[model samples]
Target: MSERYEYQPHRLLRQRVRDIPSGAEGVLMAVITEDVSPNGIPHWVDLAYIRNKSGREFTTAVGNIEPA
Candidate 1:
């Protein structure tokens, strides 16, 4: 079984990408707008649209998010 993470809507979460390039040293502070899960796994939350501090929103896989 794969590990799962639960994120709530309207919550602020610090996110960072795995295996970031050496020159890049930063993480994104975003707010969870919604939860997206294609599979019916109770503890699995797959995707979400997060709005960054700059007000830019993007979609990313849950596995790529590192909790801050």
Candidate 2:
């Protein structure tokens, strides 16, 4: 089984694309359990717990860039 991630107490972060093999663009939400890089900035994001304008919850890292 895969590990489960919690969404409660929604946390926000200002992370840079460290790896995007795909050409898609979009806002990505990842588990901030550990720091990835020095450039990976952390911040509180206003998570509404709803689909984005494009009807997506944290798109793939390679997906289109979604607004925050």
Candidate 3:
């Protein structure tokens, strides 16, 4: 079973991306739950909007972020 995602504002995180440096740190601004399943069970996927030190922001899958 998939783990339930929690809203963790102000949490320090590291964005896991190919182009961005692994050491770059960011903050978890918000956790958004999007309902992707409309039929039976609700398929809620968690997404995170992060702001890096440079003030740049981007959204990615929750799995793309990790504790920093």
The TM-score leader among the candidates is: 3
Candidates in order, TM-scores: namely 0.33, 0.24, 0.48
Instruction: Report the lDDT tens digits of candidate 1 across residue range 1-68.
Output: 34344445433245543312222222444434343355764544445444555666566654454443
Candidate order by TM-score, decreasing, is 3, 1, 2
Better of 1 and 3 by lDDT: 3
Off by over 4 Å in 3: 1-24, 35-44
lDDT of 2 by residue, 15-58 (tens): 33322344333333543232223464543332322333475554
Find the number of clashing residue pairs for candidate 3.
Answer: 0
Global lDDT of model 3 = 0.61
> Per-residue lDDT for 13-65 in model 3, tens only?
34333213344557767767766676858788777777777889777776666
TM-score of 1: 0.33
Q: Which stretches of candidate 1 lie over 4 Å from their true place?
A: 1-45
- lDDT order of candidates, best first? 3, 1, 2
Clash count, candidate 1: 0
Would you list the clashing residue pairs of candidate 3? none
